[model samples]
Target: MPDDTAKPERKRQARGEKRIEELLDAAAEVFAERGYKAAGTNEIARRAGASPGTLYQFFQNKEAIAEALMARYVVRLRAAHGEAFDPAVAELPLEEMLDRIIDPVVAFDRANPGFYALLADPALSPELASAKKPAQKLMFQRLDQILERRAPDLPAEQRTRTAEVAVHLFRGLLPLIMTATEAELPVLVAETKEVLFSYLSPRIDLEATPQHNRRTLTPEEAARKAAHIAMRSNVTTDDVLTAIHEARAEHVRAVENVLDRDHPREDRR
Candidate 1:
């Protein structure tokens, strides 16, 4: 007699993998269309042609599927990195080198907008968050290698810092560019590249004193300089000072808003 229980368990495992793939595909579509917060697990199961119970057998919930999807994304992104940094492309100029670094990321976001949407969610699962560290480290390693080869004169510390800064700057901006209007994205990309290059290679008089030696002004001295400038203009000193205060207040408000959006406040009993 066949071991009936063993056969059924094997079939269940096969079905479970197939069902997980289907669920991930459905979840990706839903996340792209409605975003992570608005997406529903039931809708994903429905699209996958699986019952809710079947879906649950493979994943604990929608968040688990999202985490899996992000893991798959990292795998695909690593492949893209290989493509971007292949030996054939390594001969390109520095500008093209920068493009190679950025293009893979932008292409991935464009190809899998839903997965990118899930990554943008503030409530991302811990597994997905942990996955990001390895991906970031790989990106940093790649950029650091390229910079070392291209700008051999750059100090080791500066190269490391630049790689760190570039990865973060691009990661934060890529999602915004992915979601921006077509007309707006090009402008943003150009301006971002300009700012990055300025930071990496500022024009300096090699013969003059290093920029680090410039006298640092105290807050009071800075304010007095501003006031003196305001006195020469049509604007009153009071008006200038008030404008400065308002700008500071607005900056504080913006930081608080970002914190509130990214983190939950504790409830008081």
Candidate 2:
């Protein structure tokens, strides 16, 4: 005999999940386009090709939809943060480490446009803001761990404050980045990472053996100095340095030629 009861229940649950996902995706698009204040649940249902009743079955209102999308984004953000700060890549130069962190975070924000809308929505009440606190807290906790590893000797209180500041600053900047056009985003992102790396790298001890490379440029400093020298040209600091050396060599040869002419080589011989 077929067990009809369980099979129908399973199918119903699967369909429910699919409907929820469709509604959320539609809500994300609508929220991103019109923002939370202007977007309506009916429009979300229309975008999803479902009736208003169907949307109501999954979400009581637009706020409910926003909350659901925020929850989903938080899960994704946590995963991205974990991957960015993976301990396997911890020993990389601070510049590379910051790159890893920034790339994943920017990617996440780009992938979920509605997340920023809801997160930074001016009309959001304190209750809505409270819902996001856990995710923010989780991110800060992960940052604290990263900072602790980078500067193991840093005082616990100081480390906590540093992590909180870093996370808050990043959160504050992300909405602006999200608003930028695609053509302008890379430059903005690059500048942001450069600023962040310059600010944070010196505060932590990242080099494995500092004494071994006393004169060697740390990646952060090297990039900044190189970019300065390169300016608007396709030149690098190494190229500039090489040109200086060649000019010096040519000057030395000219001086030697003048001396030899003034006191002919054969006269000495």
- What lDDT does each candidate get? 0.60, 0.66
Summarize candidate 1's per-residue lDDT along 166-256 as a digit string, tens digits. 5544553454467667776676566445434433333111222323343433223333333343343343344323323322343334433
Compose the digit string of candidate 2's lDDT tens values, residues 1-269: 98879999999999999999999999889888998889988899999999999888888877778778889888888888889878655566766887888888788878888876786575786767777666657767877788888788888976775565445435534544676678867876776565455545545654543332344333333333333423333333333232222222433344334434543544322
Q: On a 0 to 1 TM-score scale, where does candidate 2 land against the true structure?
A: 0.73
Give the 10-residue window scoring lowest on summed lDDT in candidate 1. Answer: 202-211
Question: Model 1: how large is the Cα RMSD against the reference?
Answer: 11.5
Q: List the residue pairs that clash in candidate 2.
A: none
| Deviating ranges (above 4 Å) for candidate 2 | 206-269
Error of 1 at 144 (Å): 1.9
How many angstroms is residue 13 displaced in model 2 relative to the true structure, after the best TM-score fit? 1.7
